[model samples]
Target: MSRYGPRPFFPGLAAALLAASVTAAPAVVTDPTAVTVALAAPVAAGMAPNCATPPALARSVSAVPWPQQRYAPERLHPLATGAGVTVAVVDSGVDRRHPQLAGRVLGGTDLLDPGGDGTRDCVGHGTGVASIIAAVPHDGSGLRGLAPAARILPVRVSEQQVVDGQGTGRTVAPDDFARAIRWAVDNNADVVNLSVVLYADHTAVRDAVGYALARDVVVVAAVGNLHGNGDPRPYPAAYEGVLGVGAIGADGVRADFSQVGSYVDLVAPGSDVLMAAPGQGHHRAEGTSYATPFVAATAALLREYHPELSAEEVAGRLKSTADPAPGNGYGAGVLNPYRAITETTGGAVARSAPVIALADDRPDPALVAQQNRRADARQRAVLLATVGGVVVVGIVLVALVVPRGARRRWRPADPN
Candidate 1:
């Protein structure tokens, strides 16, 4: 009865139903690019004025006990505190006036609103992420970042919509997302932290990531929080060559809300993560978005210690040195900053790899084309295989059932 062919009642009907179910997976919903701010709970008010002197801020943070003992960056700080490394935070702007981030933030562009200040964090999400990566705790406050000495370059790509002290919606256009990444690479960012996620895979975004990798710029992204939906690969986290980071708790177990996927490359403490919030106070936040900066800051440390290592090599070192844990969601394992900083690689430098280029960076058109062709071919092959399988199964079922149906129709009624 179907347009494709006549329907069979026995085996053919079963085969058709099987094929339909096989292809009935839920349609992928492509949500707009947005900042991943999970839970922001104001724990305590550290100081009267948030913009205190470095010494005062340190004193305030030192009074807190959890952040210092949790990740324990002090063990590796003596070796390298991410000196001379520039980390670009591409998210909802950063609070340049935050006491912990004073004098560390560099000039960055605001792609969402041109001519606007990128350092002014209205949503507070970006500031939290930045503080966790490079906030100086030397003055004594408990709010110490992974790489205290590293410089932060704040690139604002998403506009945060805050309602009742919580970020309700943070959205960025695909083009703006791509532009912010390219801008970071062009500005010589040593490590770029993307604490936002786009549900759809935009080519412009992928190209920008490729461009960063080619220029030896380390790109780290959050693997996204599960928004009630099943795990979906988030971009630029899911993009090739990006270092995707998932969230773990203080107990070293994966956070329940952290999205699991093959693209996840590292895990860090995200639950009850104490960091600087806007208005000079400290907040305990949760999400993979918070976990990503830890990895980015660690990348900055590795870059500082091993300046000779390529971007890929820096990523490899992080993966190789991670504390081994089980699960595709956990990637190689939980981030081991101590081992990452101190471990020696037998004094061998990584081999030189081809660099991807931006528009102004002498891009190779032929190489880009070849890579695209390969990706296209692979996609086409998958499609062909799926369709071929359905057709083959249908034909076999028809062959088996046609003769049996004929026998049943031709059989004499007297036999009954």
Candidate 2:
């Protein structure tokens, strides 16, 4: 009945718990050269395969998701709606036919199949990710994207989450996964959202991430969902320039499944978060994958409003403007799109001042030290001058007062 033949369902694997609903979890792309990252849960028997059938269509939702409500797109859009920016979703294919995604998706590359555009979503992960970034509001539905005006460039690299069993759809090798990142960059993507996670680091993937960063592209990725299973270091999240993201629930605490590590650069709403389904509805999903888009969308907004800012500068702004971290494992803190968009670099409050040029938060230490030395010199000069003036005044007073006291015949001077 299924494409992968009737394989015994492995209930012990971590994927089995989330098998019913498709999540933004990373799909392991098997290759001889690439290191294989096993699922977070221990495999009792053989590795667990993808679902027997594609995910069912999610029911339409009218209630505004908690992330959306918390970010309050109404307030953010007035400032910047992520206009004139393109965010590449490097994950499973994105279903561009969704009502909310209409006119927002571009004809992107599909590494899996070269003939077709990257609009077909068999796994439904990319669509939800795209929705969080740029899906437009429609028909009074409360569900809308953080950057509705931004365009999505989908790069379909994997079709299913299966690691051992290759299903009907082909999964690209790790090299091709590297190629996908290059493709997204070549296509002029301003921001790239990587909901996919890999436990083991690979040279090809690491190099590709460096390529994107070299080109000034903002790279946002999930830290991985393996806190229980040793929380192996995940990449491209752990890559030097990549913005490693962790997930937090509505309660503003790190999700139990979200990996805790030094790589986590920021946290966003990930638990019980709502996302746009493939066909025509929404699904309640949670993962570092889901949380990745919120930061990606915020990056989109930042790029839209401040086009001159380099990718690293934009990332700095996002981190600097975030709310206070609840505790460890929560990177800069929860993703605050409003603050990310409205605040200046180094956490300075934005005002009605005319826009001049972008500020560099990381001033050169040498230059700073030099300025400090100059300031100290000026302060010392001013202090010396003041002391000299005080000494002169004291001498003048002594000269005048002594004479006045003698003239007063050793009596107290009278007030005149």
Candidate 3:
């Protein structure tokens, strides 16, 4: 997905970011007594440095048993499984036969061809992306989505793709994408995930996205993956009221190529992150493209919990409570499922005391300097003490020689 990244400006949040890296971090609490914030900046330890084409999936690992996988949809399973919510995915296409996503999908439209074949996974990318939103762990193998009960409305725009010199792959046309968006809205999808990015200047695409928003459908679009200057003018993301998401890595750092700007709304795990693929396999992909589904999944969960919530409300909950990252550029930081499901995200209100965590994303130059200065002072004090002790010893040695005769006279007079 190649679009634009939102670099939201919040001077007040900087303090919270500073506080997050320090001692005894609390659960994303806004108000607490004396949370120790490390004045030092955070290191982008595990983040992908720049936008690179997301690599193909690693050789399939033995499928993880259903009970022991990280992507197991435990917290969300009991609530609703997004049973009543339908999410539309505008991308390559999905493989309904994939074990993890079996039987959960609802009907969808295909814009790539005249035939009705939205379930085909020509690129395997759509299957992977859709499964990540609603995959069921089959027979204790493969990955499950956060909201597996939710249904996928897969809309394909391309047969396959070839990644050009730029980070994005080319296959889908912009006109097809616009048509897909309208189809999603017409089909009553509560959330629409756009995982494809193509270059086109058309108002119809914006109108499609806006149409979904007016109907209270969440239009989640990836902020594209062009890392440096290859970024085109803002597309569906820049359109008002659409939720634009960026791609970050497992390190909780922003991907270098996921476009960054004032329009970006949030980010999630996108780099080397594993999800279901076509042909009974699993793999990792990069870019804001892959990350948008995670947000859509969260929206599905929210709609499941509170069917009364509008798209704006669901979006607010996601962004407000999202996990705070120091350098994460948006109103919300990283998209965290555990927090989002429980309504524990710190973005709920303007924090009074500031949330403190040990996982800050910036470097604290002042803190480093203080530590160095303290060490230097301690060394100087120790040196002075050692010198004073040595001088006292030398005086005692010299006095011992002179004092004997004088001491004898003074002592004898006293005795007499």
Candidate 4:
């Protein structure tokens, strides 16, 4: 598959991101060109070896990423920090050693390796996605997840890696993907984020999504990054209950590679998006896969703020509160985390007004009657006041005119 990397935020960072090579432990990317490996799926995890060779470590970046400045998730801390919410990351494994993710990740299930929890990341993709949703904030580092207090349940299902210019990694089969989702839901995950995308829709995957929805779990998936490659709809994004996400750049427009379709329910900052690497430091990447986490993170905030809300209600709240961005495949709009948590859904907050759909332009009969009553009362009061004022003026005029006429009654008034 032919894939392109996203442009860097600054001209100087461009060379570092698109570098020819990098060196690190067995779990990171080696060739910088292969960092976009998130888009390529070559082998199945079921057929591949249990162990994975790490690629190169991600490059260190100190500057605050654009997504952080745009979303300003910190403002939502007073309202909701995703407390008591569990978000399952159904992607590559998450590295528990990251300082930002410490104490926030749960001992999740790893379908690839049953002996260990889902904390080990081989491709570094899952680690980045996890950080975006729940990485804790630290000094000297502007990078932090949207819901820092939310617990992460890592469901390691893919060990995808890139060797040389081609794709060589172990990803889960369609059946395994379904099992992964079911495992997350069964493990009591409030929200499930699927950064992984499959081109074809599988019956097992569809059924799994339905199962999650039935269990009242908010499921989010990427719409895929194959806009240039025929723009095929990806599953389980196209699945009925999934919140399909697309990628947007700093300009708040759709990323060039993000797929477009009715399946897309929302868009998020994905182009040149910053993420925590498997071991240490941060790097920039882009794709609908990256965008999926933003919505998932917002779901976590909603779940925390409104524990009474169902999975579908949380999803609906997000869609209804998003900033309006019309057409060109920009879903409902950019994900607004602060509004998602603070906005009222006719619940305790008492914020968002009810949207009454009018079948016709005519006014409501009850409201019209109420307005008519108010108008009639006002008209009666005004008429009485007008009559009183006219009577007073007439009496004053008659008194003045009659006195003046009496003074001039004896003879004709002098013409002066």
Q: Considering every candidate listed, which one attains the maximal lDDT?
A: 2
As for lDDT, the candidate ahead, 2 or 3, is 2
Error of 2 at 410 (Å): 56
Model 3: lDDT equals: 0.59
Error of 1 at 361 (Å): 6.6
Alpha carbon deviation, residue 9, candidate 1 (Å) = 47
Which of the two, 3 or 4, has more lDDT?
4
Off by over 4 Å in 3: 1-72, 140-142, 163-172, 198-201, 328-331, 344-416
The CA lDDT at 305 in model 3 is: 76
Give the range where candidate 4 is weakest over 10 consecutive residues by summed lDDT: 16-25
Q: Candidate 4, residues 1-416: lDDT per residue as tens digits?
A: 11222111011222212110111111232332224333222211111123445445454566788899988876988888889889999877788777778899899988767766888876667777888898888765678889999999998776654455443444556677788888897787889998766555567777788777766788898876656555666667777767888888899889777878977888998777777766666766666767888889889998877766767678888888888785679777888888888777522212233212213465444334535755776799899999999999999999888888888775676899
Taken over the whole model, the C-alpha lDDT of each candidate is 0.67, 0.70, 0.59, 0.69
User: What is the alpha-carbon lDDT for the whole of candidate 2?
Assistant: 0.70
Q: Over the stretch 286-383, how does candidate 2's per-residue lDDT look in tens digits?
A: 67778888999999998888765768788888888889976899877778888877765543223233212223466544334535755776799899
Total clashing residue pairs per candidate?
Answer: 9, 0, 25, 7
Query: What is the overall TM-score of model 4 with all chains considered together?
Result: 0.72
TM-score of 1: 0.70
The pairs that clash in candidate 2 are: none
